[model samples]
Target: MFKSSHLPLEHADKKSWASGGASSSSPMEYPTPLNFYEKPPMFDVKLEQFEQSALDRLRILAEIESCSARGRPWDETKRIVSTLCQKHLRLSSNTAGGDLGIMDTQKEDERRKDHLSHFVLRLAFCRTEDLRQRFITAESTLFRCRFEEATPAERTLLYESRDFKWVKVDDVEKKSLEANLRATLTGFKNIAEQNDAWDRDAFYKVQWSQVPQLVEHRRVFLKKGWAYVPARQQSAIVFREFEVHLRQALNMTNRAMPQMDEDTRLTPIIDHLSQGFLAGVASDWQYEEGDDTTKLRAEQVDEYAKKHWPLCMRSIHDQLKKDHHVKHYGRLYYTLFLKGMKLDINEAIAFWKKSFQGGKVTEDKFNKEYRYNIRHTYGQEGKRANYQAKTCVALLTGDAEYGCPYRFLAPESLQTRLQISYADQGLQSSDIHEILNNKKGSHFNIACTRVFEITHAKYVKKGEGLGQSETVTHPNLYAERSIEFETKKEGPTKVTSKQEDDDLEGIIMQVD
Candidate 1:
């Protein structure tokens, strides 16, 4: 069993099999400290973009490895690549062919070429110029032809003939690579066993993709089934060069491609990715429920949600309750929260999208309808409204995938619910009108009405038919006191209630 940061010290019990690694003095150095309320460093959106882009690149690279351009086994290789690209990256057979230059303009034979071309472009370049150069110059011999037609020996020969090189590692680099690989394998096992949405097949696929990188880093570079003689350290040189190129490509994507208004670009992608990951996790969360690490009993979920409902998912929950609608915003919020709390991204996404199964809405319809609403809730474009939710997930749970910075307790009210703290200053009375002056003749009142609906089953009281309730019937009082008595402070010698009530007729009663 791999060690967990949350597990209590084993000395408290005698059956301690796990070793506690070196204890650290600093809090940040540890994995998950309980009270991790540091200002979240600016989110690494670039990193996420980089990882996704790399996966796109890998799908094509794998195809190239499988197919050789020597023109022998092209037909069989083409079929394999078609399936792989379509399954993973949604590229069609014609598109894959267009990519490899087997044909042009996406014909029946050319569909594979087109799909492969797009994947390669996404992999190697941030701009069209680099993409053109890479496509034109990439080694044709590296493309795969057929897997079964050739024996392992023949396949190895073909791989060697392609300009693609693999090298044997020296003792030092081999040890380092092996250690890293071990840790990665262990991490994968832990996550898989937690089983929060990671299926065995999908888990294996992701793990397999990392193999080529590991192998290249470890083995000596191959030329003709023999080690290529480079003067000092050519393998390291090649690896470093590849990483540098990839980093630059990723940086360019961040700077140039996602340059639309925060609402238009980053928000939609974030919402989609977040929901995708959450749905994936929720589907798998139950798989490990009885395991040692996961004590998440099914029965406890409903109770936990009830007690924590107000604060559990403050922003999205409130939005859903009031609007009687949950679109993109609700999905993104819940998904991210799950991710922050250590659920796998794929599982989280699958779970959420699946949750909508009982509803009439299809996934596409749901995304189209709700995508923008979520982005708006995050205040992604810097527009500050009275009810706007904060963008930080960690504020709620210190887990980026699941933080909720806007929860508050209102158990005294029947509609006990979470809310973004607005302007409660502990003062009582009619000073509310003056305090809410900026909110006058605006949607702030409407926002308050919405909040009520969210906390209670209905924000507005139900009526016989359509129209809204009377103004006096609305629950939100702009201020507890009138503007005239805004300065009236309670003193030891305060006037009696009867006297104050009698004198109050002379106060300024400017009702809007």
Candidate 2:
């Protein structure tokens, strides 16, 4: 079993239990700890603190998830995660040149936040198998990064505290098996080549099954049923164990998921976090003056669609035009994009009502069912929440007709659409094939950007100023960049400030 030092256990015997009878006439007093370092706070935290902490942690985890999904090298992921932790969570690196003694107060608080945030995400992710697997993979990578970043002394302490037991290979046995060890163990080969160096270090013997990664990498020497892992490469062995134990724990958590639903406060928070994770962080797409896109008049949408809109949005617009209506998810998606384009509630109603009237939807039926939803989207009704544009991540993960075309569309379907859409623009079939190939290899955003580059090849070759060379992760970003490219032919075009561009590409996330 993998036990986290910071996980909280509920004790029925505690006097402060909600269902327990009071022993004194006065209200039973509960012990209030100064911080989570000493004990888990059973009471509610301040709303601001709760939200800030969750958002900060979410940013870190989201980066880890994105990096893992892209198959980034572990060293790069570790550096990015460590830097983000320092910037957002205020948790500094423990591996700055030398081993430092633990600072109890600071370290404990950091540990508490790490523990609680993980459990919170677990609740969010355990509802679905796909979500659970993603969460586990990202979390395992994060844990490995932290382990690698920790000082050797800190790692030793952590290992000892975890009580993992492995038999050590004796010096005499090591010498007797020198030839086999040299032949089978890659790490040992270097040390074996130098006399007396092999005897200087201790070797741990574990079951061959326990270190499948090393076996797969051919990094350990195997004899009979045991694998002899060098102390230096032991972290790999330990991380595999961590992954296995975590996978089992997550499966168990999923089975007990029903109990988690009772906590209404946390349930909603978890839901939002899951959505944010899928949609990209909410903060990334905040509009600033130079980078902000102009709101298009309803009449101008088709014009803008031709010159600026991304393939996904363009596809949705075309479908709406063809059928004079869209399915529920498609309608919601299209409406939000229009809303981001600054379509007023009145204009939006007129536009939708006109489109639907030509279809099976009567004007009276549209007013009855759809008008209020449009008003709601514009924040004129109900909770008055301002709906933001849908991001590529959210659309890709969503189980809806409206999603990223590069991801959701079948290859044949996508090819057909690309050919039809770009026929007049002179995009070659070879270019289309390359774009689809990139999408197949999981370069989804890159594929979208490639479409833009191909269509705007003249402007690109002429060096018309595009703000930055980033993959288009949002429809709005694509539109804005395309607009800038088109406008530069007539006169000077406004570009996003370096800081704003960096912010968009950095840790600030887009919330849908």
Candidate 3:
């Protein structure tokens, strides 16, 4: 709906942004900050640049979703999103100054990357209903933020540049609708005050469908299927229209994606990007000092499993408790997880020692059979691999029982587990439904992250927990984060066992 510098690749000339020497009269000036991605940008791009830009944009969209999922305040979400965009996906306007070294050519390249990346991710995310809706929410929020921050003159230019068919209400028409317009004005106590506001502001009439959110909120005057939208709330029309066009484009793109399979290079990138998004767009994670894991205790394993562990680890812990023994992979997964949580080797031996008692694996057999494997995990025996906790990516393809529950559990099973686990934390049927939907959509990491956020919503609403959730990357991350939020009242207790870190040089040495 907006005039973009973007030109569909099939129709564009061979010259790319970086390559050029032709002096064309119509320079590729994007002209405005906001875009609706009406055309795919034409450019000679290498596969590396294609993948990188797509990822950078995907990060921006993921952050927007995370902010909303964590219930961040709108103003704060805007601030955080702005900072990230400036860092990873900056789109400077034509007039943006040299203080930032934004040359005309550089500006064109930025616009090109922006356009290309949008289309690439559009292809990647268009494959499913869940993906399409997720894409819509993130993209709409991004468009709304950019529209809100644009200068008044730029905003007007944006509207003029687009063919949205918005009709300006005349003074004569305003008088006829003045009473009804005034009715929609909030924070005004008197008719005179409402009249002043109604006269001072402008209004645009658009199809009611284009601004459904405003109509639904009863913030606009609706008559005969048209919405009389006040200037201040006009961004709703922009966002809704963009969303509408994007949804249609995505479905079209989804149909066209099969043709992309012929482009062997691109197919993999698109598939990988889409798969990564479903797994929650992995972010780098590193353990740091002062994490609560240093205080982990053997006796707290059951309670912590209930409160802090990811579904995968929790399932293994439960299996070990009930049966007093786990299969080889589950034992390996859980032992390394406990190690990564900084559980002392002595406590590790003791925890399994106690867990395996009163069952087939007696204490003597646990010491002879299981303790060796636990020590091997810590580099005290065997090849000294000294394994770190498994990542969600690795675990998803690893052993069945210890892998992601979101990836493996039946809908009924997952729902029942979620219901029982979070019943005390105000888990609603809708939350359960959302988790099930994401699971069905194969957004396992996102589903896991949602479970974390929803289950902890009680404390977060009270300003007492980690305000945001990362897609579950590792069991230790889930474990540590849960310990932070769930046990706030108990506080970080005294270290029940050794808190000192093992030597990295010693641990990371070649397997012996």
Candidate 4:
């Protein structure tokens, strides 16, 4: 539970958050590395902090889903998830680091963020059945990830903090179950080869149904209806318990959500976070010209679109090449994405002018019809709104010609492009089938992320973990990540990181 250090429970109001004047009087305690998120924090959060915390947590969970989708080994998954947690959800133990006073403050702050973010995401994800299931799986996996890294003392602290109610297998019962335990020790070759440190091995008895994963994997010694889970495999029980509690909590949150619908200030952020998760890369961070890695030229559009563009932009590029014209929305879509790719206004005008000229448009006509809108998109005209590239979420509801190909293109057309057209840079036949399966399930962005990885395989080194940046939420993000991964050899991985900026006025997040 979060300490009421920042706000008094009686006077806790959303007004204080809007004014940003809350102060901490006392410190909070996290006590344990793992959390069940069983209690909702009563503290207030500023709008920005609320949004940022949910986004940070969402990134970690999104990466967790990606790891399983990609079939990463547990060690690799843990390593990748651990690194991501350090960045977004670091829950460092009390004994390992320096300066207890300062470090404890930071750790408690991190835990506070963790607690609130979990509940915030609950509110965001509880709106739909799919969302609830996803939240349960991701949150449970996150708990398991942390539990695995917890020290023995930290584990003890966790048991003290929460009543998991798992019964310990006493030494008498342990000896009685020795034959069954050895029988289920499938991970080992023979009983004689097993270690002699019998006193060190610990076991807990739980209902067999509580940990079907351990039972199915033969990792636990089962008798009658009880599964005796070893200390080393306790995560299975913990994960199952976390998942069960979360599923029930989501239902409760959903039933209590009517009041939330009236809070217009919060619902949009919640919806935004939900949409980002569905898109497989939840972020509100806007990109800027300063974030661009390459000085893209007009001549490079064709080559780059062929080599580096995601399916959405690549499909649009293909349309422009074939017809020398795209409809209004299609042109707008391509222009904004190109702008995000850091194609200078002059080069953008040049690229469009040349492509359109090949069909019906003369220079004068191109200047009159297309050039101003391109300039308008670049913030040189109209309201100077500086429209952003349509994210994967936005693309789903936008024009089919300009939208994500996975969502818009016919199954036959998508298969042709993936298997026949982009196969050189994209997926193998089996990879195409797997991605198409995701597409069938309406996980369009996940399918796009899969395509991006396959096509850009040369840029990705081993252990190139998936993070928000690597997931294809926006067409520009796809291009940016492609460029970043290709060029970066040894620097810290910006491979899955997004650029943060205040220029979100142009953010095109209005999706259904």
Candidate 5:
């Protein structure tokens, strides 16, 4: 059992947890307090350590949330959570048939990590009701799984260590309640020695409201507003308490959220982590297997836009061509897409410079303000982080032409764009209507994929097009797959620098 004195009282005060204290020089100086769920508190961590621990825990919780939202089976969800805990958090599976020795160094480390990670995530998730609820559900499920798998001795130790004061029914009371209890309790009907079993086993007398799940399922015997719950059903009551406590904690944390805004570094990190949770997992673009983009030149962007770019990228390209300018977000999104398509930095600069020619942006102005951002996307400047293209969720929630068109565009506007863009490809009004319906139903990615299939019906092979099973995630993925389909129809080809420069000149002349 962890000592309460070692536990940080900072969490109890809303302001303290949100505003972490001065940077600790060593881990031993900053020992985390012990808790019921997480035993053996961790100590001595730097700011980076704290941030990373929080991020790791967030990943597990995010995965759990995703699994729940998708209605994945309980066994599969448990399996995934268990695997993640073992791999990332170093927590061992209680059901895996071996007892972790009390003095085991690795076991102690894992326990400390598991304990600290939960508190760290609490700081990030307490800001919103939606986030709090999601975090609560995922964390509750995780704790329940661990509890269920615990060995008999561990379970007894845990139950005794907790503050629960459940009272056991007496022998005379048990005898009187035996018939009702047997009928109401799950798995107690066919006992050969009913009285013997009833006498030997312990039952807690809880308020009827405390075990509502049992009452609803008719699994507990209720009399005079009292619920007679067996040992096996105690988990329901205990987990409910866990949920209530966490909910209250989160509400308190939400009150402290405004203070977090003052810390710019922490605020962005939290926002980004929250966004990542909503975005689901990152997509594997399979860039390792070299594709047609390797041989393509920047000048071929327009040609590729017509045949290979997804609806989102295609919309951005058309807007840039027609208006001869795009907003900052549109430029960032489209430039990133182009870079993903293997357009080098110099070619990207030329493409943007040409696109802005007939607009308000002059070449000198573009260089002064826009050049660094373009280079930054390619990891050639600033942070030099090779940022991946935004995911479907990111695009869906973005503003000012930054988001996915299928999600953000008005129904009529989307319909009109699809009609005009694919008019020669036999796009019917019914097709447009169906896409609109998908968008209404929150199947935005599916709607975009449907547009792709409709535009490239002839090129899509049997059982090869975007089906109900496959969801279009990244614009880059859409572009890569579309290019792959084209490459299948036509043999491999390469673009020379002369061809790229010629295409660039044509684009510039058209703009002029």
Candidate 6:
């Protein structure tokens, strides 16, 4: 009954044809477009149900975040989610439940439902109760400290000396403070552009500087007041307590509330808004490859599905491979999602066509250049452009699991990373020169994100010999390029939020 605007043929209509044993040889017919030649963007989530589904999926993601971050392993969480998918989300099983082996009689008409009733109970066993108790104690202390910091000051000083009644001289911090302001501005901008998914209004409003203010101008009431030390810290404290309550609520409804952030201006909003989306994407109808051959009995199918469940979700399994690339994971996960969405190759082509609007490609041009490319990528009789399309979609979706799509580097950070890499590796200037100047030699930032792709090389044995290994590639081998400087000893020690520290404390408590 649920029909996407991009593909409005009813499920019943689809099922009718499917029941009659439709195959690629005997495909069901549908309407031809009036102007496929005009080349409009092929796909849009035109259906309200689709948007609602996206939102519903986001809600479930919040639940997953709250649950998994508390102590649950991704494997366990994924398994439960996979089970839910099989029961309700009606994707047919072709081979066995865990893999797509030689296509064995595909089952049509089965849809999986998300009945997440036991999500909370599972989370309860995810960690020991003792660990929960210690987390409560530590987080309680943090909550108290944060709250105390937010308390109103005992004395309030009015900035109204008769001579300076219009404004307070006390607020005149030196221009040097501009550096801090700039850093804050830049940090917020980077986060918003890269991570935050919600609309701009949710985070902040930029204001232009206005000079020569007139008296009694209500809009320009920039007050000069010192923030009391105690009160200044309480905002984060208050929000953190709220986070704990969310954890305790356990039920999905409580999880759906937007996460609270500590910064009044930006960081909190950016993290939560994007995380809300990330979580949403995580919770959409669980997808798994399953084989349900009629040759196998119902019990046999169930056993098979359970036994090979991990393989069916190979997107998760490939993480263990030495040469596992994050982009590949991003591509794999996204491709499967598109496939699960029931988007046919032609429909997918249409979607990409729309995505590249305002480009040089008209319909005819796109068809000649990229149309077959997308088709072939999605396992259709098209070309390799489909594979390239997956990468583009991954970049658009902001799955940093594959690395940043946009080239986001603060020049200073890049410079520092380059210096560090060279110094740490003891590479002489001549060595650097050789890499830069040699036409055949390549320059590699040991910290570059592309290192993930080379991990597949791990499985290949080194040299012409039988089995001597060379180097093992892992996450650590790819250095973090972001420069982190040590703050002055007198400066505040870095403090992580209760949400982050809870897991550590819980682990310790469990051990105790």
How well does each candidate superpose onto the true structure, as a TM-score?
Answer: 0.22, 0.69, 0.70, 0.82, 0.66, 0.18
Q: List ranges where model 6 is wrong by over 4 Å.
A: 1-339, 354-359, 381-512
Worst lDDT window (10 residues) for model 1?
278-287
Identify the leading candidate in terms of TM-score: 4
RMSD after CA superposition, every candidate: 28.2, 9.6, 7.8, 5.1, 9.5, 27.5
Give per-residue CA lDDT, model 3, range 1-512, as digits (tens): 11122222222455555445223344555766778888666546656667788888987887777666556799988987888889988877546764233265566677777887898898788889988999999998888888778878778787887788689899999888888887777877787887787769888899988887888789988899889998878787877778889999989888877777666667777776776664556444433334564556899888888878778888888888888878777777787788777787788998988988878876776766777767877778756644556666656655566678888878998888778666776678888887787677566776777777677775554212234334565567667767776556454323232122222333332221
Ranking by lDDT: 4, 3, 5, 2, 1, 6
Q: Where is model 2 more than 4 Å wrong at Cα?
A: 1-55, 93-104, 184-199, 280-283, 287-300, 324-332, 342-387, 391-399, 403-415, 418-474, 481-512
TM-score of 1: 0.22
lDDT of 6 by residue, 1-512 (tens): 01122223222323332223224343212111000011111222223322233234333333333333333464544544444334433233222243232221132112111111112112221134442343343223323332332213211211111111122112234132423322322224465552332122111111212111211222222223321111222233234333444346433322332321222332332233333332122211222223432122322222322222111122222331223222334434333334333345555565445534554446786677555434444555422222211221122234444422112233354344334333433334433333222111111111121122122223222120111211111111111110011111232112222111011111111100
Model 5 per-residue lDDT tens digits across residues 171-226: 78887877887765545456666655665667888788877778898888888988
Prediction 3 TM-score vs. true:
0.70
Candidate 1 runs further than 4 Å off: 1-218, 221-245, 258-512
Off by over 4 Å in 3: 1-28, 70-73, 93-109, 175-193, 217-226, 286-308, 324-332, 335-339, 342-388, 393-401, 406-472, 482-512
Better model by lDDT: candidate 4 vs candidate 6 = 4
Per residue, candidate 2 scores C-alpha lDDT tens digits across 179-235 of 766554343345545444455557888889988988997888888999988776788
TM-score-best of 1 and 2? 2
Evaluation by TM-score, superior candidate among 1 and 3: 3
Model 5: residues with Cα > 4 Å off, grouped in runs: 1-42, 93-103, 186-202, 256-268, 281-325, 345-388, 391-400, 404-512
- Scanning candidate 6 in windows of ten residues, the lowest lDDT window is 31-40
Comparing 2 with 5 on TM-score, the higher-scoring candidate is 2
Error of 5 at 277 (Å): 2.6
Query: Candidate 4's residue-wise lDDT over 419-461, tens digit each?
Result: 7557787467777788877777667877877777677677653
